[model samples]
Target: MVSYGLEEKTALMTSLTDKLASTENSLIESTGRLDRIKEAFHRSEARYHSLEEMERNLEGYQEGVKSILLSKGGDTSPLAGIHGIVADFLDIITPAPNIPNRDNIEGELQAEKVIEAVLGERLQNIVVEGQEDTKKAIEFLKSNCAGRTTFIPKRPRPEKYRIEGKALQQLSNISGVIGPAMTFIEFREGYEALAEYFFSDVVIVDKLETALNLLKETNSSYTFVTIDGEVVESSGRITGGISNGKSPGLIQKRRELRALKNELLRLEREVSGTEGEVERAKNEKVLLQVQIENINKQIHEETIRIVNIDKDIEALIDDEKRIQLRIETLCLEERGIDSEISNLSSELNIYNEEIQRLLAEQAEGEQEIQGLIESQKLGRERWEEAQRGITTRKLELATRKEKRESLSVRLKELGERIESATTLTTDKEESLSKIDQKIDGYLREKSGIESTITDLWQKKDAISKEIVAKENERAGREERQRLSEEELKEKRRVMEDIKKEINQFEIQKAEIRLETGHLKETIYTTYQINLEEEIKNLNLKDLNIDELTSSLTALKERLNRMGPVNLASIEEYQELNQRYEFLTSQESDLTQACETLHKTISKINMTTREMFLNTFNIINEKFQYLFQLFFQGGESKLVLTDENNVLDSGIEIFAQPPGKKVSQLALLSGGEKALTAISLIFATFLARPTPFCVLDEIDAPLDEVNTERFINSVKDMTGFSQFIIITHNKRTMEA
Candidate 1:
């Protein structure tokens, strides 16, 4: 029985050993796959760093371009027309005080606000006139500015002015008037020519009565304008009642800058997202490693269990050998008792007692059997525990595999984002190029439309004039008919002679009527509108048939003398107008694009300033802390060379060493300089430690005591970092 049990135990051990070996092989294969996955993840991660480098290069390019655009004649873009500097006088003279409510979100200054401050009220039409054509001059009340309208035509000054130069001072009490254009302080400076060309003869007044008075007084030379920007031309013709907003030129550059910044920010976010994906892949890899570690630990534990089981089996065998020796002794005693029973019959009773003793020995053997059963139960428990561990590890291994697949999915997603970002950038560039190429064609079409519109307007004006003249004649004819009807009714007997005359005159009138119809048909053919409708709407009396017939003949003769009028201008104008609208839309889109570019540049500037300040602050804090530590007791600080603008400044360090007689670092000893620098270096390490740091001959200037201190400080930091210090100092090398 013992031999059979030993053989069974050996067979079970052999199977468990084989199973563990197989599990280890599977783990190794899984580890290899995990390593490959991690390598791929790391490669993908490197792309994020490359993107960061690209972004830095792009920023450098952006800055260079911005500098060029800001320089005089740096951007000679004919389409943009950025000719010269335009500085607001108010900003220079009485710079606007900060008002929280008045923040310009887009960083664009409206022309209305500017003109109101400089020229007077900007209610309707009057904003800064020099800012392109804010509205159409011909369609004065309505606004359309397709062409560059530089100046208002000159008009004669008012003949009888009421307000004089000094009287203007008293009227200035009104809320909104600035004096004449020339009165502005800036107007007297470099802007004199500009003001003279556009606003020289103009006067601004607050009240209409003041304007009238100014006009009356300015019969001397000036035209008048009310505070709301109503113009009283010197010739008595008034213009203006529409408002123009900010000029395109003022906002275009900044808008373009901001647009570029927006794009850069978007790209940065895309890169950041990809970085997150790489991190996730790394995390998945780490998780798999952890699971693998746990499985290895489990395998190690199983080996320990198997060794303990072998020891237990060996202990059981030793106990069995001792039990066999005891059994052999009992059997020898039994044989002796049988020999004695044969020698003496009287000793039969003693033999019965020996049998009872042997029965007691059999009870001891049952106790040994119970011990063996308990040992078997313990081994079974250990085997069951190992099986559960193996099952749990397998589950973990499967989870790691699932995570690997998930990482693959994330990598794919990251690749897609990169592709999309690339495609979008390419498309945007191509679209902008296309727009630039098409602009010249748009300009030509726009010019043609303007010419056609001008001719159509002239023809319409001529027709309006003719209609007004005919209406006046019809009114005169109606009044005469009423007088003539009364005169005819009073002379009834003379009416018969009049009737005969009227009948004879009617024939001549018919002939005149036919001639007038022909003239109207010719007029209608030339111009779409006519005076016929006005005449038909009127009720006329035929009291002067003879005289009217003679007048109509004179008109017919006059019509024959007049040349034919062209009727093609209207149709040509309509076609040109459709083309013009299409071109205008394209131009508007181009304008928006320019504005976006300006905005992007401005945003980049703002972001750069903000980032610089934040980095400067963090570095300053670290430097100050490090400076004091290096000195052992003295104070130090870092400050910006220019406090107002971080982007345009450099950093400055101020430090004082311990026991220094003087205030400045220039007074520091050689040893003190090395110590201060080391302190600063260590402080930086504490703030942002790299993977490895090297100091070359950093302790050369330090004495034995300070060198030992430096080496010791470096040693204390070694548990979390690696440092290589090169020095000829024996003490430093020993430490």
Candidate 2:
């Protein structure tokens, strides 16, 4: 048994004391929780009153709404225009009732008739000029001045007089042929016919003889025969005073009078018919006007009734709208109350759950308390038992301590006896000195061995480094050889391709040469010389043959470099190799350049992206602010960013003012988002002006201020660019 000192005993007491404190604190916390549970049961009366009031209001309102809605009858009225009231009612009716459909055919026809009556006649008139010759209509006389100038009343120049009289009769007959008559006059004597003809025609010699006589008597070089108002004929050769004849006959004037009378009669008939038609149209129009007035009066009365019906309908609709609003409001209120009730129920559930949890906790706490009481009673008994055990240990410790004191005294005497033995101490000290010297020599030898090992390690490292360098050099040389071999292989491939191409070209050239009879030899010689020169220029010996052969031998161990010979000859092979090397070098340079350019472009794009975004954001925000300033509250967006292709990547401005949800720009009224969006867009245009801006009807949707804003934006833009805005807006035009 080991004895515990006072210090150990004190530590055990402090540990027990700490455990007691922790247990007591747990018990106190449990007691406090029970107290809080007791307090909650006393404060739940106020919540019930509020819920009761809300429930009562909701009930009363619901009843009031149902009573009001059930107290109206349906209204009846006829609707006009393209559709009817009955159709609208049919659309509204849920379950169709057994009723006959109304017939409105006559009403539709009447409406059509009214429209037609209002629009007058659709008649058209056209005038065409008359083609008939009116020469016979104006009175003019003609007479022979050959011998009639001095023949007072003696012989009267009877022959010429008869000829002139007959000619006048023919002219009169021709006037009858002017309109509605088939009058033809072949002169009784051919002389008169030829004399009266307007155009030249063959006639008998009598007319020529008379013409000569007249010419002789009158002593005139030419003569003209006048019929009515027309000069019907002219003798190319005539003479004397008959050239200027007068008072040829009385028939010409009478023929003119007859033609005038016929035309006048025709005009009188036309005027009478026109007058009758005018009178008929006037009477019809008047009757239609009277009918229209009567119908208008009836329509006015009907319209008044309809307007009253419409007002009633409007009132009914308003009532319905208000009722619907009220009902909806009531429903909302009920729903709100129900939600509140639900929330209360959730709260009550929470409370119930809390109470149940508290009760469970209380029950568990009571059980724990009962257990603690039992444990405390048991622990107290155990602690008292331990106190008894400690008293027993103390008795045992007293006995053990007495034994230890006696042993210590004996040990002190032995230590003094050992200190008095001097000879043995001197021997041990000498031996210890020798051992220390041996240890020092051994340490020095170890130090020398360590230096040798370090030197060896340095030498080994140098050898290892040299070996590694040699290996690396060898590997690099091997890799170069391999690369050279690959170049040879690639060159051979290109040579093969060129050989195939040249072969094909030669085949084509041969065919062409065969067709060229005289030029074949010349063409072939030129092509052969070109091939020979190309073959001669290839320096096959300049390449590192041994290194290439060694690499090829090594490569053969892994893979076959030359599987088959597709090329024709070594010349083609060498030429193809040179071409391949040139192409490969060019390809590598291009690839590297492309990579560098791609990186540079990517960096530039990254830098410009931030700048573009910043500009876009600035423009987007400014435009939106300006749009809102004009529109009060709506949204606008950058339909396009600062990208060059605006139309391809155009963004749309979506404007929906506060409380509105639809995004359709068209659905907004003329005064709403249109002007705002237009102003914003124009402002954006001003920010980045181009060569020319063409605006078509952009200002057609704006008010004065918004229009002014747009125009000012345009004017501002015009400081740099040409602008052509097509607009019907007066303010835009004026601006």
Candidate 3:
């Protein structure tokens, strides 16, 4: 009962174990499902994050593009003027410049400087009247303007300067050259005219000493400048100092943007290389797979051979067992036959002994008959019966002998059959043993091959994993490439947007500047006022019309209430205005006459000054060459004494005589003065070409050397003007 109870308990435990096992299986399945769900959740979260990030990035990109065009709350960009499609392409192709102060700057040197920077000096030069170098710059800019400065400004005529051949690159003493004044302002294309007009003559030098030297060397021909922003006038005077130049940040930003484009090109090249490597890896993996297929084919053939060998070994074993069973059965039969023959032989031997005992009993019965005549008959009868039994025993012995002989023959046959069966079994067993050995060898070889195949499979699996990893890496790289492409596209889109905005800003800036200039010109022309200064601090506010009307009505009512107060004052004012008009008319008539006289004088003065200027220019040109001839080697120039007032300006001669410090004309010797006077008279005559000239002892105090110079000077002017010389010196007369 205890054992039975123990068995029952064991059965119950087994049933519980089975149920627990089933529950474990269910739990494992549920866990796998949960793991898959978790993985899916993670993937969804990552995707959502990526999407959100992309959205933010896109918004930022758009804002950045917009900001590139916005400055001072206005869009003075080239993109504004350009058509939409072309502007987008323009962004991809060119480096756009940033204009500063689009809203507040116009008709100033700063504005022109910005224009020059955007459109380049060559284009600005073309847009403004300038020297030969300027024209050359214009041509150069035109030749190279395909991808740069898409917008151009209306032409402006600024003051002309003779910046010629040797002057083009002759910023020798320049400390650092700032661009044309157009480079400084952010106003649009039209504003370039103002900058060009203002900053045309600015040239920066290294130091004050350099500026002074430049001023001295060229007679301050250009507006010389110091690096610290000190300006030198053409008359060797300095003005403006201490950093008057604007920042070059806009130009710097343009260069940086160009650099970024170059970086984009470089990264694109790298991406191309990565793509090629990925393609190569794919090709290599394909080759590896081909090799794996070939190996698999060989392994499959070997596996089939091993299976066939196993089947052959099993069949041989079955045949050997059948042969062994046959041999054992034959051996048992042979032993049974031998046992039957032996039993027959033993029975035959017993028959022979019985027969002999019967013969002895017959002899004993004959002896007893002889010994007792009276009982002879009973003895003979017993003896005869014994002889009869002996005869039967003899017959039985003969039959038994015959049966033994036959049995021996049968045993011999059985023995021979057993020997044959044993031999056959032995052969079969040997064959079976050989087959087992062969099977064992094949099995061992198969095991080794199988082990090698298992190793190959393991290696293949590892290689597959590596390939999977490589594929994943390639996929990752491809994804990154795709992302990079998307980013590049985004950048391109932003750049296009920026370009369009910049173009628009440029157009707007031009319009705004034009309008501002027109407004100023109109205001000044109509009101004779500096409108810009007046409006600089002015702001307009909206008025409530209803409130203003109510106030006006109240004032009218107050005036009505104070009626009859100004009637007499009005009458008196009207009477006084009539008298005043009569006096004013008389004054006006006198003022008109004075104005007419002043105008006549001014017109006459203007004509005289104009004629003087024309003649002076011709004379000045001749004088320079003439002075060089007279002095041998030095420069001389004619300057205005009162330059600020051209009509009343007096001529001041500046001559650097050869081997002499020509500080003042009064310091010259008498002979030198005479020479200088002759040169000037000759130059003047050459300019206007007077028909007649008379000299009264002009060379009265001349030595031989002076006389020779005098004769030459007279001869030079002999072409157009007749000269009469009353010289005591024979040398002067002869020459």
Candidate 4:
């Protein structure tokens, strides 16, 4: 029974030992698998976070689209009609349950790059409900002075381009050609029109060569985009290149984000499964250990029993041998006493009875020894089983030691990886710090350059004004010189006239003297009185030559036909000469005053022109700078309607926002006009900062992002100017 029990226990122990070995191996494998799964899970999680962050930040979106998305606050009313950008609606072609070949088709087509290449910049285009929404979005953009963007209406416009049936048939026949580009993409329900609008004339091919072949085989009215993002235009232009993976396109990024999310989920599932497996393996290991301990305990108890039985059988054999030796000695004594047999017969019979009892006891001792031998054999078998169990345990221990070593190695590797990661992180941080330092240095340099430019602009304006003033002064001097020359010529003419009059007067005086001489001679001949002596003695207050001549003519009336003369004519001539002299003095004074007044007016006009040109130039430079700031990039200037007449010339503002044509202020969109006007105002402020400024809803047209910029600008001016801004915008109010 003990042997049978030992045999059963040995079998069980052997089986348990095998189970324990397998469990240990399984536990080791499960632990390794769990670690791998956990590592993969962490990696996937990190990647998912990175992609999520990228999406959240709108990293690849255009400036205008980013602005729009960022400015759309919790309230959806303003952006209610907006259906997001075109890229948002596009997705990778998914395998449909009904289509067995869908995955194959999807794999063959590079949907992301193909769509990205086909859509081009239109991926950033905002989709709107209609023209009204487009108008609203435009207004929003203009108000914010955000960058410009294109808009696609939800209501599809008439299709102006369609692939010809014959061309389609020919394309289908062409090898390596996918169908229309639209067929490889999936979009939202209402965005079918947009898809069609953007993809109607585009075809997809597997390669550039295939595209070229297809183009040659068919009418050259289709634009083909290859799977590698190469493009073949209908106008016989081909563009093909490799892309550096630094900045993956927006569509590619979106695709990667989705893939990352799915991968992360899968990793999470795998991790959970692995963790469960590891737990089960550990539990099994614990149960096997318990079973092994119990088997060893049973083996130990059976060995102790076998050892006790062997000790008992040895003691019994010793007693049996001693009794046999005693019986032999008694028989020898009885043989020597054979002659006295009669006398010792009774004693001998008693001794024989004792011997018989001793024999029976010896037989019983042998039977017990045989049973103990059988028990020893069973115990020996159990000992061998226990030895096998020990061997298995040693193997298990070795396996466990190996597992521990493997875990240690894995841990060491993980530690090394962590150290390397830490080192890499440190290096990245150092690099980032260096980059930041470089950026700061560049910013400082940029600021210095800006300041220098401003100073240069100021110097240029000052020099221009000085030059204008000098020109005006030179012009005035030339004008004054011309007037002086004309005045001197008139004076010379007057002097010549005076000389002619003087000569004529001399001739007339000579003739009068001759006449007087003749008269004197006649008088001397007739009345013998010297005329000179008579004239000197006479009181000639009223005496006139004509009157005297008349008297003489009367005396000799017939000698000459002299005209009649009045004596008061001499006084009248004297009065008229005095009046002419007074009038000439008045004319000279009036001319001088008029000349002074003309000079003053000219000075005033010149000063006004100088000031206007100076201010205009300064404002123009500022406007150009501010326009570039507000619109991100563009050109703008203040033009004079009439350069010849700066003082009275009208200023025409010409502005060109980034990605737009140069247009007059009136021709720009409302938001563009607002931004342009705001830029002008800011430029004016910068040119001539005021002590205090009042802005009433100036930011009303601006979105949140633009309002933030406006606020920042306002803050920059707070050092020199005070601003009173009236606004309803939350961002503005918060600022």
Candidate 5:
């Protein structure tokens, strides 16, 4: 029995241990399941939330795209002329093949040359205008020229009009002579003028050389020679008028003639001597000719360069023609490309529109799907909560079952002990007697154990009640979890259906976009219009108009805040600014002028002030004596009271009556103040009177005693200024 009891005890302990382990394992498994369900529910919730958000964003985006499309006007208007000009300017200014090259300068030069040559060949002419002698001279000239020259008409000068449009004047004659005869009769203008007659502002000729040659051959015996339009004459070459009828006069005249003839003979001899001079002149002329030749060579080189430039110009013109042809070809190609671009632009617009529509439809569908997804998330959360409650209830039931089993085993053990003790009592009487105390103690233990069993039974009953409540709650939670799960599944199924619908809508959208693209391409190709560019331009215009309206409103508000602007005030303000500026500038000038004046005046003042101080000191010494005559004994001095001292200081007259201790001007009477003030002003004036001073009633307050002293001082100051005195006293005025 002991062994059996021990075995039962060990088994019971092992069972409790196994039960606890199993419960722990089951709890772990259930907790893990619950955690996995919750994780799944969270992921699903996140997916549903994201889908809902995306649906909302897509809806807003779709609306924005529609508004953008509607804002742009349809392609219905042609571009303005200025717009075309702007486009052309952009195309021409861009670095493209169609722009004219810089070599166009050469082409223009070639055209000019051609025009000039044509004009020249058409206008060249010849003329002749003299009688027999002139003809004989002309023949002589022509023969001597040896085919080297041709005659041209001479242009009239301003002074020549007085001489019947002739080319010669009394002071200056100009005619061309292409000859070597060295005769004045054979002179005529040259031929180059005829070819280019009307083109020049001035008629050019070989006037200097011809003038020198004409002077040499002329009949006048004065032998006037001009070079480069300047004349140098020797003394007394002109034959002055003679006094007639006197023998001496006639002899003198003959002597004069003889002398003139002798002078001519001497000049003839000198003319021969002039071979060296001529040689020297010829050498100098050779140098000048060389310079002229160099200049002519340069001119000829320039002419040839001009001719080559003309050839290059012709080549460039030809290149320009070729380029124009190429430009035309490029324009044709560009037209074709423009047509294609127009078609593509229209097609792209249609695609964009269809894309917009599809996006809108997709947004609506996705919104519905998102709503379903949100509902599903709520359902999943409910299901998860319910599942947690069911798991908790199951755990509670398992725990209650464990406690009940423990209670039942204790009750069975107590009943078995009572039965075993009654059977063993008679067989072991003596042993039992010895164990009576132990039995009493065992009885007490039994009672305590029974009470414990009763308490345990009560506890078991309470636990059973809790288990029933838990079972009910668990069943309710299971039902709720099943219902929530069913709803979640339904929402998921609905979402899937929506997704399928969206896929179908997407396919429809793709088909519509394709058809729209094809239709747009057909319409664009037929119309040759850039619908997309038109729409883009319209969009820009709309944006600009909106911005302009906003700006205008803001400007109006600001204008309102500022109130009415006074135009006259504005003009006056402008005038004032101008005047102020002028004044400021004048002030600046005056400041500089004042600085100079200040320096000069300062010097004058310094000298004059010092002189006045010295002179005042001397006068004060004399004035003080005159005052002492009135007061018997007194001291007087002049003092300055300010730094500038222009008006601050004055002459002071101190007087003390006989037997008085002090001498102060304040101690004097009113008549004395007037007399003393007048004397001081006069003495100060004697120092520096400037131009003029006025005395108004200077002796009105003075008595006769002091008035006499003031009059004497005024008479003393008469050397300094022109004084005007307003006084009632005739004696004072007379003084």
Candidate 6:
């Protein structure tokens, strides 16, 4: 019965052990699933946060649109008139409730690139309530000096392009034609005009080939956009290609954000369910463990009971052996008594009483022996039964031992699994800790970089202000120099006029001297008299000859008829000539100073241009090299908008990645732009190495291959420049 009980208990324990193992496995699996779900949820949550930040910052919107949206307060606010961006108002069309698959058209329509290609920059066009609102918004944008933005008034305007009636029907009948692009979008009431303005004359097709065929067959002016974002314009120009991992458009970002949010919710629910399952399994495991322990205890008690039975059987066997020995001694003594009775027959009369007593004792002895034999037989039977019981117990014990060993082995396996799980958990925790440390370090570095950038911006502003002030000073000096030059020219002209007057006076004086000399010679020859002595001798009171007096009077009258003449005219002419000479020297000095100033300015400008061009050439060379290195095969160059006016001209970058046409930097896709910018930056660094360079997610848009190139480039520059890179990419972290 005990063996049976032990068997039952063993079976129960084995079942419990199995249950525990299964529960343990279930718990482990559930825990692992929960962890996975949690990881997914965290990733989704992070994505949602990033998208939310982008939306909040109005990252991809035009500057004017963002300005208007952000300008929600104050008297000059255009927020009242603003109706948000076109992308915000429009939604991708979903299938009807009854249609199950709907040919998977909804997914194709939801491709942001398709809509983006169809609308182009129009997606960022600010929608307004009316023309008045647009005007107000424009005025606000202008007042704020915000960048330009296109506005679409919600009020209907005259349709510029439309496919109607037969044309529309014919186009719709074409194979692979989805419909007008407008049909793939949904918008609120009163936004139809805005939608039609962008979507009119635009058709969506499944393939570029279909769009091309439609365009060729119709021979009409229409814009066709393939679902893959290829655009065939009315002018027969085709623009299509895969972009270099550019960030999704705002519409796509919104859609992705929504999807991530849904995914996060689903994961959260799944995590909760998994946790609950784990909890249930844990509870079952605990219950099974308790039952298993209780079964073990019962099995232990049964084993102890079997052992005690074995001890009692051993004691009974020992007692039977002793009793058999005593029986043997009594039988020998009875035989001796029989021999003595035959020899002492003569003495039988005398010992009659003694014989009767001996018989009585013998009878008692025989009865006792019979009782002993019966007891021995009972003991033997009992021993035999104990032996059978012991055999059965031994088998049961062996079975129990086997069960215990199996349970022990299973428990040991569970322990090993638990230890492995613990080790894994420790590793995961260590990894998490390391990641956290890295994050903290990155955050600190980011903060430092931001602070540095802020300081640099402040310094830039200060430098710009100083430059403006210097420019203003230069302009003021130029104006003063111009006025001084004009004054010097006037002074030079006056000096020239004085010189001409002096020359005329000298000529007149010479002519008058010659005439006077001729008169004196004629007087001396005709009258043989000295004119000077006569003039000294003659006076008004003592007049000499009447004819001479008359001539003198006529000469005096002629001189009086002319302008007044001073006897100090020679002295005055000498003084005026001295002043003219001084003025002439001053004019020469002023002219020389003006020439020197011009030369200085020319030298400065030449030096500035030489320095700028030198730096530009070096950077451009490095840029070309780095561009090729980054892109594997590409050409890029830096161009001055006006090389003649290099100092004031804008720099334009023309980049042609491998197998691509040369395009302006702005026209490149996001990843391409990032790579291009990195090339430019590294080129500059090579040209003028700085102490340190700070890059904030510069590799975010780059793919793995390009990121590797970028890291390598950075490593190459590590000899001279220290790099502070802030990124979340695992590859970047590893590097």
Clash number for model 5?
A: 2
Better of 3 and 6 by lDDT: 6
- The Cα error of candidate 5 at residue 561, in Å, is 73
What stretches of model 2 exceed 4 Å from their correct place? 1-573, 597-601, 604-608, 632-652, 657-667, 670-673
What would you estimate as the lDDT of candidate 1? 0.51
Estimate, for each residue in 1-735, the C-alpha lDDT of model 4 and write its tens digit: 555565576567667666766776676577557655654655466557656766876866776788777655435657677878988888767541122223333235557778888777888988877898788878877644456789888767856476658867766666676777666677888777777777888987777877888778775678999878889988898877876656778888777777878887887788778768877987787887788677667666755655565565566556556655655554455444443444345544654565565556556655755665667755767666655755655565565456546655755665565566556556655655665565555445445434544543464466457557755865675466446545644654675597689679968975886677568656765566977678889989877889888888687765455544455687577658756865785587478558646755876797778878888899999899888978878999989999999987898889988897757787787778878889899989877666569999888887766677788778655534568988898888887
Single out the weakest 10-residue window by summed lDDT for candidate 5: 79-88
What candidate 6 gets wrong by more than 4 Å, as runs, is 74-78, 95-110, 325-348, 351-735
What tens-digit string does per-residue lDDT give for candidate 6 at 1-735? 433444465456556665665676677677557655765665476568668877976866776787777764444644687777888788877551222223744334544667888777888888877888888878877644455788877766756578778877876666677777766677788787777777788887778888888888888778999878999987899999887866887778888998898898899789779868987997797787788667656655645654565565555556545544544554454445445544444344434555465556556655755675667755767666655755655565565456546655755665565566556556655655665565555445445434544543464466457557755865675466456545644654675597689679968975886688668756765456887777788685765578778998999899789865575888588668767966785687589668657756876798789989999999999999899989988789999999778999999899999998857787789999999999999999988766568999989998999988888778656544568999988899898
All candidates in order of TM-score, best leading: 6, 4, 3, 1, 2, 5
Error of 5 at 667 (Å): 99
lDDT scores of the candidates, listed in order: 0.51, 0.43, 0.55, 0.70, 0.45, 0.71
**What shift in Å separates residue 32 of candidate 2 from its native position after superposition?**
82
In terms of lDDT, the best-performing candidate is 6
**Pairs with steric clashes in candidate 5:** 176-188, 176-189
Evaluated against the true structure, the overall lDDT of model 6 is 0.71
For residues 1-735, could you state the per-residue lDDT of candidate 5 as single tens digits? 323433343344444434433444444345334433443533344354444444323321232222222222224311010111000111111121221222321211121122222222221112322233234334443322211212223331222111112322332333442111111111123422232332221111123344345445543222222211122112323211333523222122223344445555554455445434444544554554455345435434544554565565566556556655655665565566556556655655665665565556556545745665677755766656655755655565565456546545754664454455434433344443544555454445445434544543464466457557755865676566556655655665687698789779978975886676567555555455666556667756446777779999999899799986678899688778767866785687588668657755876787678867777676676556555544445555555555368434654446554565556778967765565555556556644443457888877987676667677556444333446789998778665
Clashing residue pairs for model 6: none
lDDT of 1 by residue, 220-326 (tens): 45666654546676776766656475322222223334444555566556545654554455455555456544544544454455456556556655655554565
> Which is the better candidate, 4 or 5, if ranked by TM-score?
4
Candidate 3, residue 326: how far the Cα is off, in Å: 5.4
Best candidate (score: TM-score): 6
Question: TM-scores across all candidates?
Answer: 0.23, 0.21, 0.34, 0.43, 0.19, 0.44
Candidate 1: which stretches are off by over 4 Å? 1-263, 344-735
